[model samples]
Target: MVFRFAKTLDPITLFHAPSLQTSTNALNILKAASAAATAGTVTSNRGEFQLEITTAPPTTDQLRNIIDYVTANPAGAGSNKTDYAVGEVIKGAKDAEDAVKRFKEGGEGTFIRPITVDWTNGKAVLGDNESEILKMVHQLEAN
Candidate 1:
């Protein structure tokens, strides 16, 4: 008899800055959503997920991956490509290279706060948009 094990998913991560009010609001939302998901109250096809909140900036590699994820075109016919830019992720960044430069010079303060990332689904939200964040959390799995 063969037993199939369920895949372990990456936690939904929130890159937050406590000093920012928007980040605080996002944190509250994430907490509530996390509880709901754990309690099976979230009507989502993706099921329950773990929440990870961090105050520190993402590493260079992580930042790159997030930019890629956010800008990637959704798979399917006639799907419009996402128009997101690196500046959306890193405040005042001119481009990906500039983002890295600014991050290196300014450290954590350079990163935009209240960003929510669903690593398992390769989706991210740059601000405390409650509806958008929730949508990502409850996104249906592609067939």
Candidate 2:
């Protein structure tokens, strides 16, 4: 057997892939950590933590939110094709990036059409709030 080096786990700053209410353990850990935290316990008197979300690595939920936003808020009179592309993403359940690309490539142009994506190749990860996703999608709609 060979020796392997491992670092100590940091409970206070846990970083788990965000999901749609899927990470119960992470929630538990946060709750426990917050409860245990006290003055000077974790550099802050209050149990405050910072969360960041990025679009480079979006999640399935984000994809859904984008579709929902596009559906609810139609961009323009000729945005039917764009809307349909969003539908294809949901029906196909494509990965977040793939879905975004589908909408971009298939939407707008009269000859454009949504394409199929191999769902097996998808490896989506969660970001922050769904509203953040809506903003990104809104930009797509404008284009």
Candidate that scores best on lDDT: 1
The TM-score leader among the candidates is 1
lDDT, candidate 2, 5-80, per-residue tens: 8643222222233443433443444444444443225432223322222213224454445444334234566532
Q: How far is candidate 2 from the true structure (C-alpha RMSD, Å)?
A: 16.3
TM-score of candidate 1 on Cα atoms, chains taken together: 0.82
TM-score of 2: 0.21
lDDT, candidate 1, residue 21?
Answer: 92
Q: How do the residues 16-66 of candidate 1 rate in per-residue lDDT, one tens digit apiece?
A: 988889899888888887788778887887777888999888988988878
